[model samples]
Target: MDAGAAVLTALCGAESFSAAMATRPWARSPHFFVHYVPVENHQTVLTSPAHTALSTKLSTELPTDSSLESLGVQKLGMVVPKRHARRAVTRVLLRRQIRAAMAQHRCELLPGIWVVRLRAPVDRQAFVSASSESLRIAVKAEVATLLGDVLRRCRSTRHAAQAHAQPAFQQPSTVLSAP
Candidate 1:
């Protein structure tokens, strides 16, 4: 793994993907689905179960090393199901592409658990060889597109939040708080 990917913790254990976390996908590409959810603050992880007991369970069930939930960095995981890729070589190729793509966009992504799941298979006839250069390039391009969209969405959401947080037509803080 490269330095960029080394910094990223990989999500493992079934509990990490349980209902408590990443219940829904945040974005999608032609053959992939991206799921991003902020890991709950450790101090308050079990304080409130937003919907059910699963929230409390999440903390204990998740494996320690693989899940860097409390840290302010991206934790990644990929699901290239056998059903989708079929061949071991194809699955491995897809996984490498996903990791490379994530490493490329890690700096821009929000600190959270990010999963890239293979939802559909590529057209086998189009690229007969399982792990051809064309296939790798195609997967890389699709993943790049997926991450790009996620970045845009995160930026827009952040902007909207900043806009909401500031009061309209407010005097400068220096003047307003003058002694």
Candidate 2:
């Protein structure tokens, strides 16, 4: 199923921000699903007793660098319920919406690990209060724009490197044969 339609499966199963911080290569962009994994406790969060329980299960379900090779896109999934409704059902729906949004633009997006972190609460009541279809669309557009920006940066860097390396010269005219 497309990631968008497969919202339930995708959001619930995405790799956590903390996990990606430890195991994946990350680039900062304004469009991120931020969390509060402290710099000091990062190691403990990944290895702590309670976190470990979730990690072990997550390791199997979440995509690693090698696994993403098949999809040609990198993605991270996480559900962060707002402190008020941290464990609510509305959070799941938000995640699902995100997945759906990601799936819709999967083609234009770059192939690399993309993290989908959820910061809003998913409690039914919470979602009812704050969720909207447009919010999901806006987030998706922002993410895609961010990814595009990254791609542009990479291209520009490579171009700069190439420009520095090349010797200045103009190509000679080529002879053409007409049949």
Candidate 3:
């Protein structure tokens, strides 16, 4: 897959971050949870120069269309709380795993702002070291599952919204001719 196609904006700024947090979460597991909110206009929400650079790069690689324009760009944010992973190394490792797993499912995800927040710590007894390969593998699996659930939920929600937006029935027009 093209790097540009897989690239995702990292959500910044307090307003956008808070907005993502306020949205209902799509999935949750022992270690992490996901929150996402659809963005109607990427330009308005993504004001940073980095976002512009990424958008231009993506646009050049992909064909332009109304759907593509409306889809715009997808943004991601990660929150590895210290309470969940006390060691900085562990937090960094988890963050990297989250990014990689999300990248794999980028195509399935709708254009929106998504945030993955760490909720619990991995048991130390399971893996002796923070850098243990086993721990990395476990983290990757968990992240993949979390993202998969979120994507499923997103699709269902979108379908529901579309169903509601369509008119149930149309009224027939009545005409009277001169008697």
Candidate 4:
């Protein structure tokens, strides 16, 4: 799926958020962190201590990109904690930059549940304004770098998976051209 759709299409339940974060973060920047649980690992991760205790109805609620759903899609969630960004404007700005960065990168991201969290607050004294053009540009550049790192990691793994999927040697059929 396209990055735009991946950003907009799904809402993960609290249970899913907990399970996803249960895994160590896949990537981190100075101010942002990304956590990912690949679709293939969902069975083990989702059924971790939290989900195992949930009732059947609760289990049915899942992100669209989960293994049980359309596994090829990507589900994304963003968290900008109040403790980190005291102003509501700051939280929204962080989320906007994240979405914009994800969309800016054109590569096909690995299928998974993805979450980006704001890990630190910018120095208020440095920017002075809650929403400043300088802050936006800085955030945008940092987020783009963060996503770039993820794509590089995904590319290597994806290539390896593709290599293993296709046989190294195979018989080829030949056709003669008419003279």
> In terms of lDDT, which candidate is strongest?
4
* Overall local distance difference test of candidate 3: 0.74
Winner on TM-score between 3 and 4 is 4
Best by TM-score: 4
Off by over 4 Å in 3: 1-7, 41-71, 161-179
The 0-to-1 C-alpha lDDT of every candidate, in the order given, reads 0.72, 0.46, 0.74, 0.75
| Local error of candidate 1 at residue 118 (angstroms) | 0.3
Tens digits of per-residue lDDT for model 4, 98-145:
876775553467877788888887778887777899989889989988
Instruction: Please give each candidate's TM-score.
Output: 0.73, 0.41, 0.69, 0.77
RMSD of each: 6.4, 10.0, 7.9, 4.8
When sorted by TM-score, best at the front, the candidate numbers are 4, 1, 3, 2
TM-score of predicted structure 4:
0.77
lDDT of 3 at 175: 100
- Candidate numbers, best lDDT first, in rank order: 4, 3, 1, 2
1-179: candidate 3 lDDT, tens digit per residue: 23456457677666566667777778998888788777664444444344455364655454332324545467789988888787788889998998888877776677778889887877878877978899898998888788878878867977897889997787998898999
Q: By TM-score, how accurate is candidate 2?
A: 0.41
Q: Which pairs of residues collide in model 4?
A: none
Error of 4 at 12 (Å): 2.0
Residue-pair clash count for candidate 1: 0
